[model samples]
Target: SQQGEEDPQALSIQEGENATMNCSYKTSINNLQWYRQNSGRGLVHLILIRSNEREKHSGRLRVTLDTSKKSSSLLITASRAADTASYFCARAPQGGSEKLVFGKGTKLTVNP
Candidate 1:
């Protein structure tokens, strides 16, 4: 079974605004990762936060995880048309295989 599912499914925002996407999962996780995919391109690693960590930030991105709620969220600050893409959440199961289960993803459009 899939371990993670992203919320909202889609988001549209104007440039300079912030975009937020959420994810919920079942079962324990070793870590959770957020990925972005541009149209007709492969997924790119965005950020990864471990189960022991509550939050992490990199560049214009911020991520938070709440194991108690089995949920996580990704925040993209200062929206730009270049930031428009599909964002996915993937989880690495605790003591499970190396593979990460991915959600359907949330499509974000940043208008200029």
Candidate 2:
């Protein structure tokens, strides 16, 4: 079964606003990562937080992980219209699966 799934499947905001999304998972994970997809093709890696880490940030992105709760959240600050895209949370398997289970994703629309 898939290990990760995101909540609030859709989001909309103005160019200058921030966007936040949440994710829930079913099992233990080695690490959790966030990716952004433009249109419907390639996925661009954003940030990653290990199971032992509480929070991490990169540029305008912030990620938080609560391993005890098997959950994570991604926050995009100072959003822009170019940031509009589909964002997904993926979990790295605990074992040596060498595969990632991705969430259904949250569609974010930043209107200019």
Candidate 3:
């Protein structure tokens, strides 16, 4: 499958703490993206990292990609209760279809 597998199916943390999630895939990809989804809501794009990039950051989010290992990781710094959501990793194939394959996701809960 082109979809990635996310680590830690569930995570719970206190507010203001950092949260980290990992994703591993089997095949090569063009790019990998992270998305957030609140309960009963559509996903919101968080960040994307190209195959050539080793790391990238936006706001409180940090993403790292390792093509050699076909893996990636997302880090949310100083998380808040509002950050509680399911985070998914999606990948675009190197070629062919433009469709993206997504993982089940990691459920994060931040307690105040």
Candidate 4:
């Protein structure tokens, strides 16, 4: 079974709004990463938060991890139409190899 599961399968919002997505994991992890995928395009690594880190930010993106709850969230501020994409959360196990397990993803649509 998959380790991470994202909530709210889809989201729609106007440009300039903030978008939030959540993910829950089934087991302990070394780190949690978020990725963005555009239609017909490949995935882009967004952010990665280590198990010991509570939150992290880059550009307009913010990521939070709660190991005790086995959950995480991604926040994108000042959304743009270009930000429309599918976002996934990936899990890197505590003692596993570099391979990562990914969630189903949350499709976000930013309208103009």
Candidate 5:
């Protein structure tokens, strides 16, 4: 496999607290994207920080990249019950394919 799966299949946090998650993958990549999925809603594009970029932030979402370590982290500041969902990291491979192969995802449950 060209991609490595993320550890900690699930996470739970209290409302108003921050949540952090990590992902690691093997091989080279052009870009990695983070997505969020609610119970009924489809995958919503959260953020995309390229391999060369170190970090990017959006409202409550913050993403960091470490190419040397082949890993990335996501921090949600002051999470809410609305934030309860599954988060996934996907990569657009270095070469050959154009589709993003997604990880199994980390299920995040925020208690209100």
Candidate 6:
């Protein structure tokens, strides 16, 4: 089964705000990657933090991981309308194949 499943399937935030989402996985994972896709568009790789890493940051994005809990969180700070997109968290199992198994996703709306 796909390891990661993001909760709260959707979120709405005003522009210039912050949005946070959580993901939970069932099995051991080698890595977790977060991606974003605009409506009707291809997904863009946002960030990837390996199993050994606890937290990572890129631009306005902050991601945190907890292997013990098999969970992760993504925080987008000072969000903009351009940040409106669906976010997905995918996992590469520790001893499994390389292809990513993606979550259904969290649809984020940034209201201008």
Q: What are the Cα lDDT values of the candidates?
A: 0.95, 0.93, 0.95, 0.95, 0.89, 0.93
Q: Candidate 2 — what's its lDDT?
A: 0.93
Worst 10 residues of 2 by lDDT: 1-10
Which one wins by lDDT: 4 or 6? 4
What residue pairs clash in candidate 3, if any at all? Answer: none
Between the candidate structures 3 and 4, which one is better when assessed by TM-score?
3
lDDT digits (tens) for residues 1-112 of candidate 5: 7555765689998999999988898878898899999998899999998878999999999999898999988899999999999999998778767789788889999999
Candidate 3 off by > 4 Å: none
Per-residue lDDT tens digits of candidate 3, residues 10-99? 999999999999999998899999999999999999999999999999999999999999999999999999999999999997886579
Q: Candidate 4's residue-wise lDDT over 1-112, tens digit each? A: 8669998899999999999999999889999999999999999998999999999999999999999999999999999999999999999988876789999999999999
Residue 87 of model 2: what lDDT? 96
Q: TM-score each candidate.
A: 0.97, 0.95, 0.97, 0.96, 0.93, 0.96
Score residue 48 of candidate 4 by CA lDDT. 92
Give candidate 4 regions above 4 Å deviation.
none
Global CA lDDT computed for model 4: 0.95
Q: Write the per-residue lDDT of candidate 2 for residues 1-112, one digit (tens) a residue.
A: 5758898899999988989999999888999999999996899999889989999999999999999999999999999999999999999979877899999999999999
Clashing pairs in 4: none
Listing every candidate in turn, what is its Cα RMSD in Å to the true structure after a full C-alpha superposition?
A: 0.8, 1.0, 0.8, 0.9, 1.2, 1.0
Say which prediction, candidate 2 or candidate 3, comes out ahead on lDDT. 3
Q: Which wins on lDDT, candidate 4 or candidate 5?
A: 4
Candidate 6 lDDT at 82 equals: 95
Per-prediction tally of clashes: 0, 0, 0, 0, 0, 0
